[model samples]
Target: MASSRIRTFPQRISGAMAASLGLLALLVTVRCNEQVPVIMWTSEGISLPRQAPPTAGHIVGHQQLASYLEKALDVGPRNVVLFLQDKMSIEDFTLYGGAFGNKQDGVFPNLEGALRSSSSPLVLPAVSWPASNAVIGQLQDQLDTSPLYMDPDTLSQLRLNASSPALLVFRLPYGTGSDLLSAKETLSGNDEVIGQVISIMRSQAVPYTAVYTGLQPSRKEAAALSVEGGLGGGRSLLQSRGGYKDRWRNRERQQWAKEKREVYAPVEFKEDDRTCMLLWAKGLTVGILRNNRWEEHDLTPATFGEGVSPRLHGSDCDKSKARLVLNYENVLGHRSFKLVFVMSQRHYKVSARRWFTLDAVELEYDGTKATFNGSRSIYAPAEYSYRCHSVTSFRWPLLVPRSAKDPANQWRVSFDDFQIQGFNLSGNEFSYASDCAGFFSPGIWMGLLTSLLMVLVLTYGLHMIMQLLTMDRFDDPKGPGISVPQTE
Candidate 1:
């Protein structure tokens, strides 16, 4: 019986080793088959039915406008197209008088024919005179009616003809409220015209600077219309009043002088000028902490525009210096969504301190209470000495929705005063470290432990083989001893 047991030990050891190897393989297969959740980030606040945020550009006098165009053309090959409303140009109507059937009507009836026949140079007194390099091509004037009347095919052809990074200048007619009917009529027409043009530009992803020089109810009205038509915030330059013009020009000169004095000023505040994007769910309730009091601010589609903050000002803090906080909650029966906050400061600088926090905990910044789970600081060096804008972006993931069909849940939060300390690093160096224990799931740890056990098992198997190889067979007195016939 002892001899038989000794012979079977090898077989038993082999079976146990095979079983361990098979179990490890099964664990690996099970772990790999499990699904991993995916997360997405966006800069545009919660998804909405409104148009995209506007681009950045300035609205100055004709001379300053011409300078911008000239600079744009001098750099490289660019498509610069001009659209002039026949109402804004007396010369255009005079040149194409016959097309309207009666010269006194002041209407150029045949827009296509007039555009094809006109040979005069496209000129705007507010921009520049004479010619600056023949950069402006494909001038479409004698457009006496709303752009809605123009041929869609012609617009399509124009878009195709325009090169990448094109500059489209729309000098449309904006009516005043003195004549309500006329104003309504003009606005409706203008909306349709500008809307179509914007659609084309957006489809082609072209960068355009629209200059509205005609009559309008007010500067605010003009800006609202431009933003509604999808012009970028800084890119659409509405023509302001003469007083406003002088003030803007003075500011520009002062800024230029400051730039000349401190060549490194931009480097110091480089990160402040950048565009920051934050996203949150729609219909989120927000609050502002002011003077140790919390003020509620309702978030709605009507409140958001080209700027980062809503239309309503919550606190006495300066718009540039104000800090923002986002809160998210995890609960049952709610739709999961995100909010996107985009800040684009042109010729100005802005700094952002971002953080994340759980719904169960409360956060404090400078003695003000806010809710957040994590935080991060962002900084970027200036890329251009004269004028450069930094673009920094971060995202926060809300809790997974319990049900996809639940009505959107609402939450309120507030922003309070906070101090920021600056840290400068040479060249563009960045580091990220996380201490959250739950960041990794259980499967990961299990896989690691299984690998360690496999390594130990392999080492033990090797040691057993070595022992078998070097052991003395005579030392086992219980085994089937060599039949020496027991000479004693």
Candidate 2:
């Protein structure tokens, strides 16, 4: 009985171990198959009709107007009349012109020629020009005021109740009282569209010219004038009359100069005339204690250099056993802090390549110093990739006391995105200028390979173990010895 018990003991232990592994795999499968709720419940939601936002119209400047006139007159002799109308939008013009002609093959025909040929009742008058003496005199008179502005007498001659192949210049008044819309309505009533008047000069046969100026905020500004006093009032407040656009530009300049005087810049420290150690962060941010809460403040490259000082101590060329101290002061509105990085060099087990590792982090802040002792330590290799921004960011959540002896009343300080470089470095400039290394790191691939190898080894060992399950020698005192049958 003792011999039988000893032989079966190993089998019982093997069965129990296999059962536990099977249960573990089953639980993992169940956990993976679990579905997370996307939406727990639904409620009645209000549906509102959507309305498009009002868009402003673009107006051509004086230079563009001159370019258009020069191009139009260069083609042939044509009467050119430029209309400078305010409060009329380009959208209104495009829409009203489309109603005149039926679109041919899903595209509108040249509406300009169509409108001009049918212009029997539309009133656009002709102006007669004289020799160079009168032309040069008129040009010289309006040059001081506005070259585009014509006197009311010249403009008054443009009123003919019927349409003629003549130029008509209309200086539509701004504000709520505008005559341009009424003129547009009159042209539409006469079965003539006013929008396509510009394209009439595009053809050689056409002899008339109409220039349209689509201005904004007059039609739209009527609504905003009551609510905002004026459309430009808010913008004028940001930019003062003195032409200074930046309201805090001078204050920022002064603060930068003050910060320049407060902190020392980083300098390259040469060790044993062999290697150089210089540290700097591309980005830095700190949580400042304000109003019993933490407010975030980002430090620019200039401000970061003015506030933080990097120093290397110890005489190790690899900088593995050296101490890297990053002292920050006059930052976060004069809050001083120090970070000590204890580094070490580690090599991959399968390769000759080596990289640096952060062994520990010692923080000094709020008049108290503490070494961070946590379950998660920075044991991974310091990422180093050529031409990449392979930064190793460190975040430390620290407790700062309010007073010297006040333990309960403490403020939490968070240091985030403290990306430090130049660990175990030797050169004039920094390295790793772009993104980090690839997604599946070497360590992750190694782990997956190792797990697969372990599974294969376990499978083979179980197969060999199963082959060893031969029945114990059983001899019967009969004619022949009975053997246990092997069943798969």
Model 1, C-alpha of 154: deviation from truth (Å)? 1.6
TM-scores of all candidate predictions against the true structure: 0.20, 0.26
Candidate 2 weakest lDDT stretch, 10 residues? 35-44
Best candidate, TM-score-wise?
2
RMSD of each: 32.3, 35.6
**Residue range 437-483, candidate 2, lDDT tens digits:** 34576767999999999999999999998888665676779759675
Off by over 4 Å in 1: 1-62, 75-77, 81-153, 157-177, 204-211, 215-488
- Give lDDT: candidate 2, residue 174: 34
Task: Report the lDDT tens digits of candidate 1 across residue range 1-488.
Answer: 01121111111234477675444333222211111110011111112122121121112233544454444344422443344332322122222232223433323222222222322112221111112112132111111111212233345666433344444444445344445456435544654565566456556654433322222112333324434453343222332333676576568657756765642111011234432222222233444445676455443333333334432122111222323333232212223222322121122233233222221213222333323321222212211111112111111222221233322112233221111112222223111111222324576789889999999999999999888765344646777656555774
Name the Cα RMSD for model 2. 35.6
Q: In terms of lDDT, which candidate is strongest?
A: 2
True lDDT of residue 171, candidate 1 = 41
